[model samples]
Target: MKVSEALSSRRSVRGFLDKPVDLDTLRRVLAFAARAPSGGNVQPWNIVVITGEPKQVLVNAVALKIATGEREFPEYTVYPEALPDPYRTRRFGVGELLYANLGIPRADKAGRLAWFTANFRFFNAPVGLFVHTPTYMGLPQWADLGIYLQSVMLMLREEGLDSCPQECWVTWPETVRRFVPIPDGHLLYTGMSIGYADPDEAANRTNAERAPVDETTTFLGF
Candidate 1:
């Protein structure tokens, strides 16, 4: 697929089919994703891919913890507590849009929590991936991780697969470390779901809007 097509079609798919992705296809996608640039060529990322029993083990464990009201301490803040202005507005808007698409009313706390719980299950995607980086790395390395993941997502689109980059998984560090072989100094940065999207799912159709260039960016010396 063309790059433009991949960018346009790639969305954070929330539900997926039971069909398994081909191992070789996944390998190829990662190999292609590695071509994504890194500052000073540090690369700065590692991943543990899980399928079958291991994936289910994580899903079950996290679901149990969440259901039992177990608290989790994430390694770092996922979002600022006091978000400012347009950024906060955009976040709230997309969340409302997502729930609206799911037919979840504003007052349906249980309904929303039920959907949020699905993050651990990879939205039913057959493959799960854990991304890692050494704790010593700074913000630049974290940014590099985002670029690498974007490449992976686009590559998945090219391979006729779908993905969701999930920062929420970082909240359950212990559950993830038990399943994935994370190195001692490395921290779990994020996770992803990879598989065929369930075409009929309404959540998959929830397209979050983006701000126009004039609003979000400033052109200089153009």
Candidate 2:
């Protein structure tokens, strides 16, 4: 698929079919994604791809913790404690639209919790990718990591795979680190669920709206 097509087609897929993604296909996508540029060529990203029993084990552990109310270290806040202006309003609007489609009213905290819990299950996808990096890395390196991840998602889309980039995995970072046996000194950056899209699921249709380019960008040249 063309780059433009991939960019437009890629979405944060919440539901996936039960099909397994082959290792070779994943490898090829990752190889292409790794070409994303980084400052001073310091490509500081590590990915742990899990499938089959290993993936199940990680999910089960997190679900058990959630059931028992045993919280691990908290992940970074997704938004500011007190968000300001148009960005905050935009965030609220998308969230409202998504929950509305799911038949969850603003007052239904339990329903929202249930939906959030599904992130631990990978939304039934067969493959989970945990991305990590050194804990001490600066913001620029983290920015680079984000670019690399976007490349991965776009390439996966081009290859006919759907994906969800999940920060929810960070809530169970220790569980993941233990199951994956990742060494110390690296933080779990995020997780991704990848597989074929489940066309029948309503959750899969939740597309967060984006602001128009004119609202977000400032042109300097005539």
Q: Which candidate leads in TM-score?
A: 1
Task: List lDDT for all candidates, in order.
Answer: 0.93, 0.89
lDDT of 1 by residue, 143-171 (tens): 99999999999999999999999999989
Q: Please give the distance, in angstroms, between residue 92's alpha carbon in candidate 2 and its true position after superposition.
A: 2.2
In model 1, residue pairs whose N, Cα or C atoms come closer than 3 Å (at least 3 residues apart or on different chains), thus clashing, are none
TM-score of each prediction: 0.98, 0.96
Candidate 1 contains a number of clashing pairs equal to 0
Report model 2's TM-score to 2 decimal places: 0.96
Question: Which residue segments of model 1 deviate by more than 4 Å?
Answer: none
Best by lDDT: 1
The predictions' CA RMSDs to the true structure, in order, are 0.8, 1.2
